[model samples]
Target: MKWLGVLLAVAVAVIVIYKVNYPSYSYRYRLQVSIAVDEKIYTGSSVIEVVWDCGPKIAGLGRCAPSLGGPATLIDLGAHGVIVATLRSGENISPTPDGAIDAVWLCASAFGYRSTNEELPALPHLTGRRNLSVSNLPRLVWFVNPADMKSAQKVTFLNVASVFDPTAHFTEAFVEITRDPIVVDIPNKLPWFSELRRLQKEGKGTLSKSGQFQLVYNMFVGENS
Candidate 1:
């Protein structure tokens, strides 16, 4: 009986040690987004590269790729398509298209004061934080329950109709500040996929509900929307 009690104590001690050490062994990531573009469902490995500096102390920092969840779009802004009975060529100069990153990136990019050395071809200064600012809050951060994709049926896109005062300035140095595609890989049975059904019925486009969601938000922020 004494031996049994000793063994039990040892087992309990081991369990306690494990419980205390588990967090140390695990990775504590910085970013997580329930929203992902490209209609991708969220999985364990979804990631997006983001900038992390606005001023000097925060200058040239790259945020770790973030984890993401489902149902967004891959926006090809210059995508050649038939629009309003015309072969419309997408805009070139002083132009901003519509779409979103994983929700976390969007929130940080718009709301968080940060930037990176990451530069795009057309807009090399895309990460310039000296003048970047988020003038308003959109639907990204509100009630972000992983299981609520249903109520989020329709997605919208808004373009910045005009290029005016920039919170930051991108040097016109052959940089392309194009938005990257937000991608996440999730299993078929993630939380809240039922929301997609309602999205399909109410979405603005037939392509996919998440696709519409990306576009609609981009449009709502038209030019800057």
Candidate 2:
């Protein structure tokens, strides 16, 4: 019995060692979107890349990645009359003609923030920060529940149309700032939050009942939306 117990302990230790030594590989990601506008469905994909300051290694991991340099089009609300779009990370089911990263990079390049490349490029100057000037409420944070591909999430953008300010400047003069996506929360604080609820109640605004979802709000003070 003593010998058997020792063998079991040894086996367990070996398993633990093997599991700990195994490394997790990270890959660049791509996003696909399926937009539902009334009866018409439109689709596109975009390659999303994070510029790591260093290669994948413990010494390099401490380096920070840049945020998006400016407001880029994630989707064209006007061109396709996009109402609601389903976004997933891949190219299998939908095409990726309309990509957020592409738009951001292009605009960033035009402003001379970073030079563009044919393949996976890095925007070294872009850094992520919460812009309090845009909204007092923090942006939405999310992760999957049950960790299954089948689970889907629904989010609404309050005053999605009004978030963007037309006249905004992008420069390397100050640190290039890229805004994160916002999600709505309770105890409505911003004036826009009240306006959104009032419009929803009054049956006004571009967003309609058919398009209603639990709203998510992220406001970049100068983003194009």
If scored against the real structure, what TM-score would every candidate get?
0.22, 0.23
| Error at 66, model 2, angstroms | 4.1
Q: Which lDDT tens digits does candidate 1 get at residues 1-225?
A: 999999999999998765443311101112222222233322121223332222222334322232222222221112111001000111122121332233323434442423222321112233422222233112221112333333323222122111211221211111112344433322132243234333444763322233333212222111110
Residue range 1-225, candidate 2, lDDT tens digits: 999999999999988765444322112222233334444444433333333232333443423333321121133334322222222211222223222122223324433444323122334344442211221111211112212212223232333223222221111111124333322222121224345445555666423122222332211111112
lDDT of 2 at 199: 55
lDDT of candidates 1 onward, in order = 0.27, 0.29
Clashes of 1: 48
Give the number of the best model, judged by TM-score: 2
In terms of lDDT, the best-performing candidate is 2
Q: What does the lDDT read for residue 52 in candidate 1?
A: 25
